[model samples]
Target: MLTNAPSVAPVPTASAPVPTDSAPVSQLAVADALMSLLRDTTTEPRPDIQLEALTLAVSADLPVL
Candidate 1:
């Protein structure tokens, strides 16, 4: 069906930064992530350690939807 479809070239992405011997993130960032997880655990109705309810709960909680 296509008569004049142009060939698309793959775009090259920026090179990843080289990691040093030290950790990238600051200690505060790690603390923030831990706090977020704790808050989610306490406030949100977390799903149990089951395969069935897990998928449903995650889908229900999607921000895009």
Candidate 2:
């Protein structure tokens, strides 16, 4: 049962603030960010309608097909 692990005790520091439910970003914001990324990397015509629909569906907790 020999081990080389150190037995150092951790020092406690000030606790970080906990985020609330409201702190989460809005669904539209997330979608917008994703869209930006896609548009930057893609040269094809932007799939604005499809992307928006997907974002809305995901945000609404609806099943995507």
TM-score of each: 0.29, 0.29
What lDDT score belongs to each candidate, Candidate 1 first?
0.49, 0.57
Error of 2 at 36 (Å): 0.4
Error of 1 at 4 (Å): 64
* Candidate 1: stretches off by over 4 Å: 1-23, 42-65
Candidate 2 structure quality by residue, lDDT tens digits, 1-65: 34886543222222322334676444445555555556668456766898999999999999999
lDDT of 2: 0.57
Clashing pairs in 1: none
Clashes of each: 0, 0
TM-score of 1: 0.29
